[model samples]
Target chain A: MSDQPTGVPREEYRPSPSDIAPKLADLQVGRTVVTASIPLSRADLVRYAGASGDYNHIHWNERFAREVGLENVITHGMLTMGSVISRIAEWAVDPGAIVDYRTRFTSPVVVPDAESGAPDTPTTSLEMTASVGAVDTEAGIARLDVEVTSGGTKVLGRTQVKVRLS
Target chain B: MAVNTELQGSSYPLAQPFEVTREAIAQFARATGANSRSHFDPESAAQFGYSDVVAPPTFAVIPAQRTEALYITRPDAGIDFARVVHGSEQFTYTRPIVAGDVLAATCHVDGIREAGGHAMITTRTELTTADGDEPVATVVSTIVVRGEDA
Candidate 1:
């Protein structure tokens, strides 16, 4: 399916580190380095629940989630946080290069049931974009300011990741 | 029910050791869509200086959250699972968690306060190697408990 839920080009979905690393060496602050779209479904969340051992009802049980005031089954904040970091890790070409990562959950990404048609599709995707926020050449550390949006709403705030790249 | 503010500064001791297995790392990688070979192939992981398949960066949350629930689930803690919303998460890793390593986590309630008629609780989980007490990673998580009106 098209990744233009937000009108972004498909080429913007997977960014390679080599595409921006050269500029990073020159301390290119405020440069947009990477963009990726993470598609999620109820089955995906169920798999994440098994992998992460987070049996939170809001993440899977639709009835329970609504009972607690949530519109429907919602994705686990950690799962979203975890899944998005894969792009950063891929950019590093080495998963071990990421030394620090943090994020504040600003809003919920409601996962509609497949039965909920049209405007409220069940298969939603998160759009992640990362920019070069800071670079310390001496420490070989680069700080990235990441933005995560789902359904045109920013779901994470102050999302950042620090990488140690030699 | 409103969360009890008195639980601030409470620290929960380490529980049983958590073993990191290649299977678990691979499962997490697949679930999170992390396509890096280091998370699944032992040979590729060794090429990256890891002895075995390295876990995805956020995999630490699995064990850390399991430990944090020790206190959050206590009846007297006044934490209502139904009303809680994850607010934030941060992680600092000393090294990549590779397969075959066993870790133990200690959970500390770093901060608890009220804001906008809601309760916010911050927890820090320190992970260390089970064999030598060598530090592995530190995970900090903040959760908000919404009041009835919210």
Candidate 2:
């Protein structure tokens, strides 16, 4: 369960909002290729389970999680969906411009093991691509087509967000 | 799936209030891969112009779930919980909810219909200040109960 997978490194994040161009300046419209990853741990699963009241044993209890055919403790699909929201907020040219977002849970994130805060397992690598789904400068609004994945698995629920930007 | 058209637009009240605490916010931050200092530390939150550790925008679901019970468990509404697969989740925030804001979420069955071989029910939950005077955000979530096939 603690095996490290071959792909990306631990806890990698990129492209803070300050790094992006004026999203609506010239209004570049097309697909965006982005990749990021986050470390998974028991602390996260428990916290989310409590906050969201999911209480699904597969998300926490290690033994129970294994019995259910999971590689390790499974992260709540909602939690992963929530993490996607952060990437959106971070990617937007205006950090606070996110007005709405919606999506379904198509995959479950496996909880990774760690040793005293040292990563003991492989992190969930997210390779996502976004495209201009819509643009309305007058409304300061834009929508993006999104697809997320963990490892080679495509996380279901193609996500989209409506945002207000500069 | 059979039809339940009358259930459309039926509104329900929440039995409990969502208590916002600094610990709750921190817990949510850890799980969501949010490395933002403001969500985990009160001092940082205050520096960000918040009263205390502010929860991630998606953290609203914890409190929102407290109200979802009304719609999901309505016996007369003819919903079979075992067949429900979360169809969608969406959120809109008016502002960041600090640790002190006591939230109350009320669920309204905005609409219901039989579609794509499933019963799709739309639920709109309003997370508001306890007195219901100020609005925080509205979570519009929909679920589809599969018709024997799903």
Candidate 3:
């Protein structure tokens, strides 16, 4: 099949489901899945709020967040979860491979407002790392332990996903 | 204000069926930076074996949250809207939700507790076909409402 329809550059095409199916043998427990970083900008938050319909003032209104005792406007917890799963989908080469996912918002991700002079640059970055926590070959499921941190502080805790390798 | 423990085990009625549309899927995919073709293009989605555009996994939260509001928004629910913080989210999908599908959500309060002067409420929402018994997805959300002292 042509990769043109998927828009995935031919060179960057990670294994599709079929290809991943045959390589299940390589998915061992304790193996690293992938490590990625997603920079969070106010624009990303705005777009996410619009998309997810989570218009919580703490996520958008700086003054409201401050008044509520938060240091600054924070990123939506669900947005952080979405960003983490997008990385997993990229690694699996298919979003459908993920059947279950969960996470705990242990700490708030404080996103500073855009710089006074530079309005387009991201102010913070969330680093995510995932590892194979368990594998059930017979069930075609693999459990991934994901950690999301911002500025070296844990933001999401007990994050995990169950992916279908076959 | 003390946590409303009485609401635990309360089950709300099924919400109005929500129609999953192609535009909604595309918009969510774009916002989350999920560039998968299955979430955007119907033809490309068919190649992946889905009957229609598949929504990203987190999309289930939309319907679940809507249904959850029916319980949390009650005047006597003891929830302070201004003080609530989303603590966690978990999703287990019976199958990926696709565009053109209509779904309904039924929510039940699983538990409510107070710790360190804050209220923690856990709720579960079951998403199913609009007119059938087949399950679509289950979402579990935990919300924390801070007490005045904390």
Candidate 4:
């Protein structure tokens, strides 16, 4: 398992919808809502593979990845997609608030071997930022446009999240 | 090998119901680093008006992909699993999944076409409650199979 905890403790971050209502009320189009740098290590990939039941060797075996024409072992697109959405959920103060989410796998986040570094050390970090793309006050829904990048290159494109605020 | 175009437009209904459990939800939440209490604590979820622990947004992919496998793994489907790469994914949910709900997915291979010698396959999966068949979520996935020569 990955030793690094990527998110805050549940107790410290819990907020009811009533609690987050004010924050949602202040939402403005183009306002930045969340910014995070989530780290990914090989162990994290292994853990996700187990949990998601997606054990494609390209995610865990370096040689196999190269044979498949990839630059190196890469993080699963679904893993990246899944991990980044947590930021929106945290910001909305409700995991179930999100009704729509989508992303294009524009590029791979290559995870190099950790032999030279500590086993738990991250191979790369996903730099994620989400901004209010649109706010529909009547419908009480907000559209969030998320940008996810690794190694200063966009990995996921058109990453959009729609959350119910009311 | 090129993907079997004949499989396109085919639909595969769920082979069995997937019983959602708190333990599985917690494991997936931990794995994805989603730390919301609604994913683990029933009390917190109840506070949000859910009957039980609520699954994270992307949790639908778990059961959806299982149904998708029934199509992609067929010998006639012609997908080279080792060479397949995710292209895009989208999820639209009618409701959030909660623990204790029995879910089943029906997968449709919506499209399959050759692009630049590679196979571009698209699938849409509908996930619903097993008993009442209440629609919970729909997952759309696109995967590309790299050509051997490429």
- Number of backbone collisions per candidate: 0, 0, 0, 0
Q: Pairs clashing in candidate 3? A: none
lDDT of 3 by residue, A1-166 (tens): 1112112222223333454442466877788888877777777788888888888899989999999899999999888888789778777767777899999999998888777745535788888899999888899888999989999999999998998876
Per-candidate DockQ values are 0.46, 0.37, 0.53, 0.68
Candidate 2 lDDT by residue in tens digits, A1-166: 1122322222423323345534665555675633455445566666677767788677777786665455677777777777676666556623235667777767666666664444434445555656667788888788877787777777747588777776
Chain A vs. true chain A, TM-score per model, equals: 0.82, 0.69, 0.86, 0.89
> Which has the higher TM-score value, candidate number 2 or candidate number 3?
3
Error of 1 at B18 (Å): 0.8
In candidate 3, residue A149 scores what lDDT? Answer: 97
lDDT of 1 by residue, B51-150 (tens): 9988999999988998999989989899888888999999999998999999988899999999898999999999999964699999999999888899
TM-score of chain B of each: 0.96, 0.92, 0.96, 0.97
Interface RMSD (Å), each candidate? 4.9, 4.3, 3.5, 1.9
- Tens digits of per-residue lDDT, candidate 3, B1-150, equal 566799999998564698999999988886666777778778767767889988888999888888999898887898988899999999998999999989988999999998998989999999999875899999999999999987
Candidate 2, DockQ score (0 to 1) = 0.37
State each model's CA lDDT, in order.
0.84, 0.68, 0.83, 0.87
The model with the greater DockQ, 1 or 4, is 4
Estimated TM-score per prediction?
0.90, 0.75, 0.92, 0.94
Per-residue lDDT of candidate 2, residues B34-54 (tens digit): 556666666656654677776
TM-score of chain B alone in model 4? 0.97
lDDT of 1 by residue, A1-166 (tens): 3243312211312223343433348658898877988777677778789999999889989899989988899999988998789878877777888899999999998877666544323388899999999999888889999999998999999999998876
Which numbered prediction scores highest in DockQ against the true structure? 4
Clashing pairs in 1: none
Query: RMSD in angstroms, candidate 2?
Result: 5.2
